[model samples]
Target: MEALNLNVENTSSKKVTKLPPKISPKHKRINVLEEYKKRNDNKVALNLVVVGHVDAGKSTLMGHLLYLLGEVNEKTMKKYERDSSKIGKSSFAYAWILDETGEERARGITMDIAITKFETEHRRFTLLDAPGHRDFIPNMISGAAQADVAILVIDSTTGEFEAGFEANGQTKEHALLVRSLGVQQLVVAINKLDVVSWSQDRFNEIITKLSPFLNQAGFKKDKVIYIPCSGLTGENLLKRSQNILEWYSGPTLFQQIDKFEPPIRLLDKPFRLSVSDFFKGGISGMGGITVAGKIEAGTIQIGDDVLVIPGGEYGVIKGLEANDESSKWAAAGDSILMTLSGLDILQLKVGSILCSVSHPVPVTSYILAQIVVFDIKVPITKGFPVILHRQSLNEPAIITKLVTILDKSTGEIVKKNPRCLPKASSATVEIKLTNRPVPFETYKENKELGRIMLRKGGETIAAGIIINILSYNS
Candidate 1:
């Protein structure tokens, strides 16, 4: 009787209207290069990552610089001073600006990358204050991956310089990693020189010892600039302190930063954006989801249809923000916030790549890469389980094959199918991701998307560049 009643209701003359298939808006592709030409030339954006060994005064130096630059107000600084003094750590007041975490403040260490925006006379800068501790090297690598230039801070205290530059210290490792990641220009800030009474001999000695190692690590002597400054006293940061160094003549730290040449923007390529972070609700209480990351290649505009790789979810760009300012379009190298229309928060995650539906980044499980192994206790062997880091993505992977070991000094093949890749060695190897496919491109195609880092036991073991996509299994 119930089935008959339901059938009667279905058969009752309900004029059922057929709903039309939802047609997504068709977007006309804009000439990104033409758009770029219309922009003002006064502002140049550059991402600068600060790196050095543990307790090298990296955070304090940058934090102090920000304070002096007026990014941090006097009231906030006074508050930090009062709070730090209560704990008998008044010296850490400036460091507290960047090391905002309670644990970080208490321990007096920076454990994660602190990103902030500041402006110079001629350029706008995205400063990445990376951790200097050995345990946080992975975090440092993540920060360095997004930088166009780097600032290597060094402690100038008599014995401290030796402690951080010798074996097991991160100074050498940080230099090699950044250079391998394609950071061409570097500023070496010899910090805390005031501790040694601002002696020129100490400054010269530190420079002489580090210069050879830096050059061997692929830093051009001319491209590297060394500045002696006291982070605690703010000497030679914004301007040279009077009567401190009558013998020396050079630009201040701010001048060096302003001189950094910006990398050529990849505006003509296909649009690709790497999702470094994601959140549920956007700027307003609107239901739109927001994803923050840098545009790796090409350009994206509001209302453009985008394809999220690996998951293959589709979405439309509802809003766009370049460097925290709302905009109609964003081009490569601009760190942006994108409000997406159709994707659920669950469908998106860090390391996801957003690309145009017409031209999307390839998703692959197996890749061929050219790697340079850092100083390690054991050689990297086949089938060795390691953590693979690409941008913000971290996944388990295995070294599938060692194709060939290349000479460190020259590009010639040293040996074919080497049994193991030793420390300070270069090789072309195949890597297999253990979990899911990742968005990747060849190194020659996109530097930002092609770089990869390998870690094991919380230590960075190797750094590499993708040479080819060996397999694309979904």
Candidate 2:
């Protein structure tokens, strides 16, 4: 399983040309970007991930927001309320919307990501409700990779803030992880502010404390904002409650979400979609397998021939849905559900990259990277074991060689062949995947696919970008 399929023609060594599918008179190739513009009026689409510490009420906050936005029906809300009451957890009625599994309900925790689609006045969103507990950081990383922005929900009740902000709190870790994964904009919702009677002092205190750390995590000051709200009572989510907090007036959380600037789409690049989830049956009676993922580069349309990398299985797109709406084509940054034909059920994997046949992503077992080490108890040495996380893929990898240690600011090598990398150090190292070769691009070629994180013992030890592919599978 660790070897790449060498039987298939190598795009590096051989020019693999893609043959256009024969079309009828009415089925001519349409400009996908122009068509997308015409369908959405002027609304922009983006992915949003919710992150916070355990018991921070992230699920309840998002679930209630969805209900307020009419994404969840009143009858369904009532059912959740009734069921939650029977379990003596009436307070978690809204949380039940996203935590649907019986195990999650019983444990009162979100273990896996729950995805939902909703729209605001000026934007359409694919909301990924990520787990907050430390045990599920890998799942959280998978969710954050697909997000354009993040909502960091912080519990504002007394003692709660300290516990989550200090000493192994996920609030700090989540912020760093999202920034490392390329999420730029962050909305820090000071959740449960009503628990302290909407005190502006408390809100300011939280901001004052978090501002420096967030800046250190690579989030620009202007790009980060704070909003006070009660997820339980639904205050300042859709509309600001009257006479609730006379000292402050600001946009609701929904309004702030709309203001987030969507990043530039990679429409001109070769088509690449990282597979997140797939199933056997197709949508709308289409007899093919459905694959779900965010398009990382270029554009994909019906009838486009795509090759799944690492396995080299071929498929043709038969149907597609973007942001929960049926569409003819989808571009980069759109969370898509695509139905594919001419593929084996066993060939497709969660981490496989689906790309244009002619311009396929390179499959490599070894890569050179520049990584920034995180705060850790022990230093990272050669042969260090780590689980390399890229998108949804987690492979066992090791630091085979430590090339050089670089100045954190200048990128100049301070020392060559250092003994070990200490905490907060920046270094260039060579990593080899112990599991199997995976489809990946250099950071210069594709930002989404290039960024990676190394986790060891349930902690994120370092984050880096693929600098170069040392060797490609022939």
Candidate 3:
């Protein structure tokens, strides 16, 4: 087995200089105390991702909830209704709110992660509606990797549940993937129950079969909440409908959202932001570029000098906005948009990590990882080529060595340098990226920075966590 390397040296050869903060025209200084007060008053921000198999009513459920919350007005709803009816797809009118793309609307499937913001009485949310189609699993993985909590929408219309929960369906794959990536709390919304006349027996039957599977996937029975709902008719969403569900007296979807415990923010760690999207121009034709992503750790203030890892590009924070509201500083867990100066647009791209220059994430080509293998026809062996996904970055990589295979039940070593890792097994292995180094941290230190997914031929093979960076390449 290769020993883990804990020490990392600064690999950049360029002269380090302290640059003055370059404030943008839209910049405004935020007082620390005032910011704290605002957070306390508004409650902590949370990123809630909705996931399930295709045609399971995820988009419709969320869109209707947003409409009930007045996030979508009657006028806009009328327009969606009229437009969808013209295409003979009136059932998709509610889904049109989150499925903005024409392709998504035409196909009636979520092809990519659709991000939108909403607020409840107690918490503000960044809702990520992930695609459920098998072809779009990579996109779904990207969205789930960023989520703090998840809402798994299950279809309850006769055989729809069985079809989605069976082998090759996305429900099982998505459930295991999110739990492996560290989503602790889940709300399983049994949607389309109205189709079965809100049958309690059907709901109970679904739960009886799924509980063990969810437990195996790492969700605690107590942490998993089951809610019966009708995304089409808007029952048990924002408000409960007593007429349909007279036997069950439980909290609505919004209430369950309010009960979610906010994750502890790593605000004191080194600032790390993964660039998810970037644009060429800034406000008012400003020369600077605008970068949008979530702050994974620590705090970033206006005019703070930032280093773009793997590229060694420097930029200054020209402006910052959290939840589409302008602000001076952004802390961990905030989805922010930042205007950056001092780097050309070509130097910045998706998967770029923005960090404070003094404590930037290490760039490495080789890493030691603890991986959980998913069910696949073939076992994973040494020198197996696969596609590696981290944050928004996806690259080709190979498993260089199978160090040790561990017991899936007790996590004890079963064999050293096992010949192959079979389905539903666990192991520690060395992975080597093919072309360039990536910015990564160990899972113990930073969850968002340390996670990765392995895929091959459009199938997700395994999910892994970085235990250590074994080697670095300049």
Candidate 4:
């Protein structure tokens, strides 16, 4: 294992200004905070993840919205329509705009996260359309980790909503997952109401049934908004169905999107970017590998030197792109594609963290965490095998020790050395990553990097935050 190198010569408290001779001449010191502020004034950046159970029409809804906003032109949309019709999936025309893969189109379900960029009147959004099937929960969790706010789409047709919201469904799991990952604002879009003749009662009934569960899942009532719409007809999406549904006078889906407040960013902290996806850029005529992720903290610009943790590889930022436009710099809360130079691409992995060379995140194999057990069929016992998920990485782990059960509200100890952890319980436990050391931080240090999810047998058993690093490679 490679240890973090802290003796790299610059010995400064701030970001290092000295660059290697391999770096371009543009590598110089400037106040990145001032530049970020100027760009932020025009349009606040927000990451929006659309999640729900399978067949909720998530892709179609967002695809139509993109077309309405002119992100998808008529010429391209017409091709999708004609192709979908020939394949006997005419209703999936709009969905094809985001679900571009032949596999996804053939199966008629989104298998992975499809990312696209669009702008509202007051906000610029990087839309993450996550997979909704139970088998793709890991993919959904990756998308949710980067989202600042979420849209929970539900099928409002008679028996559809009940099937998704009841009996161990993805609807409940997705809602809990996003809230566990620290998403506060939610928009519950009640879709397919047009199938039921645009009935207002159906919309209210669905909301009434879902409110208590969402509240239990950690979403506040005041922060959750409900809207009624038809993804197929595009009614109540960008415009109101005034003549048919006279009951709803609330804002449309697009209006509610603009109303979501952007979360506070850690602009002055040390730079950190979690790697989600990477590919060879030389295929596109670019020279190096391109990495994509949302900046979790601080600011990074072209020519900045970054250290990839757990492997101790160094790379220089050769270029940056945000919202499909070339940018010189990007701050926290912006999802960007970074082209890196002077580093071997093999060292970059999905779970790797790129940080300031002088101040890198810790690499830990053991941690003490406070976890809340979710609704599960079986109790979690000592040495229980599980998959630990954090950000974009999931690795095999075990509950090495069951320390004590704590009160969820007061944080006071209820029992010491509990034999087993039951559903809906909170406890402090020791976990060991069996695979390798991973980049981690305490919740007090950074909220985004500290959250973890535990899953077993295709179901999420618990979610928690790391409180202490028991053992690490430094």
Candidate 5:
């Protein structure tokens, strides 16, 4: 029977009902308001990325998800089959939504971000089916940069959880990149469950092996929901299959996906501003996100004193608007366009945070860090130029010390006295900023401001967080 409930609010306006004349008895019995409201309620959505070792079923899992949600029809499924022979696998699903160039499809690897939309029973999902190849992993990194949630699709048959047995396979680097990009939650989809012949043992094995890394990534045990299903068979997807393998009793992948919440910062402090996409709004102001962090204590208004230490430049607030409406006080997370009092249009640009002079402590020398050595082919040594970025600031710094290398797989210090960070590694290092007055948070409190990426030769080599710096006194 279709689920039934009563909602006082009318949903006729939200739902465009167009179904076949013949309806199921359950559909006929639904409480109109309840049913329609459920359908019309603004869905709680999180950007879920399907990533893992290449051919680890990232595409298949997404296709299955689309299929389960009934986003794609039977005709499309058949088309996938027809294209699979031509394209090598059901990658046509990836090609279909990703809109890859002909060469990209023929290669069966994602060269860039493939954004597509689909809806589930309870939530609308925006799936970013990213590339899983090593050479093209940068594109995946670019995609993960935008994802709110990450779904790592692993094939039990392949065996390696982070490292892969297959040549030209994907790696834990992919997972590390997702974490580095500030994705808050993870969902491991053990694809091709039928190939293992529905063996709970294999699923358990993958989970057992991945348990350590999952924990290291700061994800709760329950957060890693394992779905034992065949992307081929479409088992236990959208439908809340009650009696399927009674051993598993939690919500289906669909239900879990629907319930998963996107992580967003609650603007607790006043006027803790972050610059979103910014630009020139005349000879006057700049615009961007109320993207968490609020304005408080300091009375900031038109012609108010605004000093941005990020650029070591001062300006005045000529005006502020909450979206299109004129807002007297703009708090955190409100996209606003504001005019400047004295600064030129070139002064305040993107990634600049607005704050009072004494608000967030701006330091000359601070310890900025990362998980470190994410997919680094060479060793990261001291005195190297480390590219650091947080919120909207990206700059280069000299690595004062290697300090220590923490295991990326596990946050354990491998070396107390070290000089180089090796391949596929992580570490906690003490760093002195080449430039002063950068805003950073302790990783324990707010990750958005705490972390940074270390780059060299156009590639991001290591990423870590900012620890307190060694102060010099004469």
Candidate 6:
């Protein structure tokens, strides 16, 4: 919940103040206006989620990319130079960027998600670092939710995928969850290529095993891109290398990402912006929900009439900007921020929906969701009450019906009218909420608006891909 104090100034130093030109920092301005122009010219930003089993090198690849992209700050560089011997593993590069905690490094596991933005000449990638351990699967769900693409890291020398097999040998659970979350693009970075001597055999083996799992995870071949890399040695990330992975003719990690495209979505589906965070600036009009979305329809501008439907409230847009660009108006496909004139914080929650009053679908009870269970220490009971996360809102809901649980790997129903659902299963079930007015929909109908994360006892137990909404006759 900590916003980055992102003060890039005061980075002056002694040794860093006089490094060689190549090693010296190349500062770049992050202007929203230019980015908006590019977007208007059809340049879109891509979000890539770096995920794999713990220590499979997710952090390292991120760190390597950041280093190449000149994002590792001067403070971190000094910290590394002063304590290089104390640092462990190549993945520490990315881990440092995200796992900024003693416990995270000590345990060598990513528990929460950290978002970082890195730019290449071809594209800008927003990295979502998801925890690799099974215990932190909910964190993974939360991270993957924002990603348009996923990069699954596989350690070649281990001869198996990162993270061990689930209780039922469903090591592919993360991949399944990624697909279920509506991330359309996939990239498998067979990391530690140096350890395997960049053997095509090992890479092919991993891909061979991955392809069927990708199928089970419901990913298409054209959508999946595989690359061999070494996060430690920094190969095949930003450049076309002459190293052992020459047999691979595919693009560098950057090229693959730069070419990525979010699947076809209905931009005509009406403009909806869900507030994810709020900051009480110096004044009320100055502070509103921090909303993020590529404008779907109509124009959002300063002083525009924006109805805070969830609050039954009304507000005037006092400010409008996207990607830091001073856009007079943000229309369809422009990711921007808009401030409200009036509304109490209570009227909005993390997952509340913000849309045109004409197209209002407020939060409600009795949600019918299609779920994919990634973790199960025990079965999900019929009456299990868990939390649901959407937008910035997280609310409590109970499983009113077990309904039908489908084994996606087999494409068949393993249980009918089951009292409890087992591990790593996909199902379509009726989830009745304790509260009315939770905004949700069938994921198939609208991915941006239709997904929910399931949390229990303050822990994320599962995530549901909403499939249908049933009317209440009350």
Residue 413 of model 4, lDDT score: 82
Which clashing pairs does model 3 show? none
TM-score for each model: 0.92, 0.94, 0.93, 0.93, 0.61, 0.76
Give model 3's TM-score versus the native structure.
Answer: 0.93
Candidate 3 global Cα RMSD: 3.6
* Candidate 3 residue-wise lDDT, 1-474, digit = tens: 112222333233222344434443454556644575578576768899999999999999999999999999999999999999999999999999999999999999999999999987788899999999999988888788778999999999999999999968889988977886678899999999999999999999999999999988778889999999999999999887677899899899889988988887787687899888899766445668899888889887786778887777788777778778887788888888888888878877688888877776777889888888888889999999999988788889999999998776666778999999999888889999998887888876787888888999888898878887887644
- Best candidate according to lDDT: 2
Candidate 2 local lDDT, 1-474, one digit each (tens): 001011212124222344434431244577987976776577888899999999899999999999999998999999999999999999899999899899999999999999988888888888999999999999999999999999999999999988998888888888889998998899999999989999999999999999998887778899998989998999999988678967768788999999988888888989999999999989899899999999999987888888888777778888899888898889999888999888897988889999988788888989888888888889999999999999999999999999999887667779999999999888889999998888888877888998899999998889988878888873
lDDT of 6 by residue, 404-462 (tens): 87766543666788877787667767887776655654554455666676777534566
**Tens digits of per-residue lDDT for model 1, 266-312:** 88877888888899877555568999988888888877878777677
Task: Tell me the number of clashing residue pairs for each predicted model.
Answer: 0, 1, 0, 0, 22, 13
* TM-score (C-alpha) between model 6 and the true structure: 0.76
Ordered list by lDDT, greatest first: 2, 4, 3, 1, 6, 5
RMSD values for the candidates in order, in angstroms, are 11.7, 4.8, 3.6, 5.2, 14.6, 12.8
Give candidate 5's error at residue 392 in angstroms.
Answer: 9.1
Model 6 weakest lDDT span, ten residues long: 11-20
What lDDT, from 0 to 1, does candidate 5 have?
0.56
What is candidate 1's TM-score against the reference? 0.92
Candidate 1 displacement at residue 316 in angstroms = 0.6
Q: Which parts of model 3 have CA positions greater than 4 angstroms off?
A: 1-34, 283-285
